[model samples]
Target: MSQLVSLNLPAGTTVPSHADVVIVGGGIMGTSIAFHLAEAGVRNIVLVERAELGTGSSAKPLGGVRATFSDPANIILGQRSLRSFEDFNYRFKTDIGLRKVGYLFLCRSEAEMLDCERSTHIQNGLGSNSRMIAPTEAVEINPFLRKEALVGASFSPDDGFAEPEKVVQAYAEAAVALGVRILEHTEVMDVASADGCIRSVTTNRGTIQTNAVICCAGAWSQRIGEMVDVHLPVTPVRRQIGMTPQLSTPMPTVPFTLDLSTTMYFHNYANGMLLGISNSNQEPGFSRDFSHEWLPEFNAAARICAPALVEPELAQGWAGLYENTPDHNALIGASKTVEGFYYATGFSGHGFLQGPAVGELIRDLYLSRESFLDHSSFSADRFTEATKLFREVHII
Candidate 1:
């Protein structure tokens, strides 16, 4: 399989002189948040990015957009985002190519199957259409299958994947049309503040004189937080994504399949298929280079789940970084250290699917509107003192 290459943006322009709100990073999270803010009538918003928009982790492939998560927060977040994706074509006047290919979590043990069944019940309760299918029934969903390795799985028909760049562009273009200024290839070098509130944001291009700043810098959020004396536990972890060659044999109508035993997932990638495997010893850094050693492990894991992957002459791969938090959840909402400083980062690997919902939440919080979802659970304050632990067993 081919390897994933790093694509960084050119050196950004100098920071702007002034703006009402300054947002750092122009990935899916930043653009979505900017779009929602513009929709909420925050006209004078400035989004600063070190490189071209969505070139970071957002540009990576295997865009599986699913709402059938084991965690309630993830389920709700994905559901809201799915609505936005369904309406994206009309909203942006551009086809983002969101295909409802479905999601299936392959179970390995009775305990895993029970957890999936329980999660499916919760999903149904929350108005999400997800069902637990037997191993035999799963083959109907995807005709080609080695039934021995598979037990049962949770299937969500409405879930799917989309073009990441198109979605990011749609949000950016829409936000711009609404009077939001996005400064691409512009880096925020220093975050200036005073008296527990933001004073200004200094970028490579120029200094944005804004009391309000949203640090959507993804993996680099920890450094930004340090500028304000706040210790955010967000870190960057590398994740590899791969696509297998289009087989001559008719491919089954496969849902996004995950092997519970190996934490590896493979799903339909456009016309072909895409897969990803977790590394227990992934180096922690900002590097986006693909590793050759990881592919064999991923291939073995994929074959164990779907024996079809063992066929030679079919595989391509790429790697990207995931901003992970202590609990493998995102850190959203206002900062307890600084008053006007807000943050939305550390989404782990689920950033793309959760983008729109997070955008709406940030918009509501910024505009002082009543939000339908309770975001207090996602606040950065949870890192300090006692708090509730959000467990999401279904992660790949």
Candidate 2:
């Protein structure tokens, strides 16, 4: 048997001239799709990653996996993916370190609160037991929260966070056990298409002939799509996260909370708290530098939202890039312009939580299986000139 971690494909392997399906990214989304597809009896699947597994935005995530959302489609996807995370330990035979600390979305304005009210109604319609609570009740949920400044809040008791790296590795290992080939550090330099259909993909190593291909390359999916002459409206934005040392106060089962006005979010970690804020003025390039100016802004916001988390000792921080779209929604489903080619990327900042369900949806589409949830709303064709944009505001 060959090592699954790093696939050499044996001597004279011929680079697998063809596969039943070719996945162009080895992040959690790609690995999960390959895993689910193999589980569904699609064995001749190949996943190619230009770099290491989970090293992209997947690895740089804040590890917050929750079902709290403002959109029904996203709510459904989040709920399904959350279930996968809940049963991951026994089902995948690996610990995802899931903690159901809950998610508290702080509403700072009437508009935000009304938005929360509407979204909460849709969430309840989808069977999620989330509700809008007054600022006073917000303090009850987290005594550390500064309730006076908030107008109202939304809370989902069932949602929480998990270990991202472990989960991705689990998916990769299980997918391999089920016979899904993963080619690490394998750069897919070109995607070939002809007569309005995909023929194969040409990588640096060799040619991979396949009728079906999925672009899970996150921020780079836009570039990958261009290789096949398909235009994807995904753009990259910088997001920064920070960590604090052990505080004096006992961290109450703190749920992932968002300060709506400040665009700051913080959650409890094993040793301390992980915090971050979105950078709207980010340049169109990759830079992992932890901004010092953003620190004071985030701390000030965190202190106002949750006073107990405000501490002088800021331990460490890092930054990552998100593949944001115009409407802040992911581009899913088959490409309308390119035949035999599919896409499931451009998840913006919510890729980690949505990856599992997206994988399941991709599996159903490729294997001709019935999906547990309808995904037509997220189809890539939605970005066509004939279609309108769908947006999700509650991004952290």
Candidate 3:
């Protein structure tokens, strides 16, 4: 976790008086949106970041990129983003250190195993290489797992991880080259509108008049949406991850692996391992400090799943936020209440992996073009709809 290689682009001093489009948030989400819009010939694009680019959750992620999901929307988003990451080097002229070690989810019970198989069917139908596997096969793939503990698993060789910071840097750099003005250290104070449409954005630096504005504000999107009278139920829940020192006894490189029951996941990192577990008791807020407060819970779950993990002390670690929605899915659509206001937030923990394709999706939505996937199910308005909330079947 050394300092990230600087994006090294010239800085802009003044916020523009007007822009063709104003993008809030400067993480991979906003930067990717900017890149896509600029690539589509959208001019006067302005991206605003309160701090430097790639702050908050985008700054720290295990970077596990995967398309293995029970939900069609998530599966499609992941599949498309995997293709973008694969072609990123040719398009952006930078190596993102992508490791296609694949992803494997270990299931403990008949219920969990049944769910994995069911999800695998959906994944395979969407042209993914994922398939359900026996406990023995799952152990063969990762070798670190206890075969007796795992009843079943699902794996896809095409899904893997990459450096998230690099992706953000690439998109920001490319967007800047495409004439997108990125205003770092500038914070948005208010969003002004008239006649149910966006009129301008007021920031700490200055106000910029723009007809269109998209909220890519990640975990803080709830606040941003409120400014425009839009309800974007994005809550900031901190997720922590830690890396182990290089193992004394070299372990076989394995795919990104997760225990479905406990949500304890681990993957190879710096010749050691990156480990994380969801704190079920975690409150929704913006606390990004890594702590041992959840160690007891993680240790209890680790014993049940991976006995080899002897509560290894993870002294070096960082915490990041997950822009969680009520049903743990994404909110990607325009606002009916506020015209010229759009959003793409609340991916739960899937934002980083889905950023690339989502950029294109948001760009198309902005331009009123047809998107590859039907985004109706993902609209923010569904929260108030009479029907039941759309939920993702498999999550980690």
lDDT of 2 by residue, 218-298 (tens): 888989998987878888777887777876877666788888888888888766778777745567666656676666667
Estimated TM-score per prediction?
0.91, 0.91, 0.94
Q: Which prediction has the highest TM-score against the true structure?
A: 3
lDDT of 1 by residue, 1-396 (tens): 111122222345444577888888888999999999998788789888787888887887647798887778888999999998999988889787788988878897899999999999989999998998888888778654567778788889999888888888888888888888877667777888888789898776667788899989899899988888766688888888777687777666687777777887777765677767786768788888876656677767757666666543447778788899998988888877787899999989888998999999999998888997888888878877443333333331
| Clash counts for all predictions | 9, 0, 0
| Candidate 3 Cα errors over 4 Å, as ranges | 1-13, 387-396
In the range 1-396, model 3's lDDT, one tens digit per residue, is: 233333322454457899979999988799999999999999999998888888866887458899999999899999999999999999989888899999999888999988988999999998988988898898888877888887888999998899988999899888988888888778899999899989999988778999999999999999999998898989899888887777778778899998888898888886788888888989988888788777677778778767777587664887889999999999999999888998989989888999999999998998889999888899998897633433332331
Candidate ordering by TM-score (highest first): 3, 2, 1
- What C-alpha lDDT, on a 0 to 100 scale, does residue 364 get in candidate 1? 94
- In candidate 1, the residue pairs with backbone N, CA or C atoms under 3 Å apart (3 or more residues apart, or in different chains) clash, namely 4-318, 12-185, 13-205, 14-204, 14-205, 14-206, 15-204, 15-205, 15-206
Which sections of candidate 2 miss by over 4 Å?
Answer: 1-14, 247-250, 307-312, 386-396
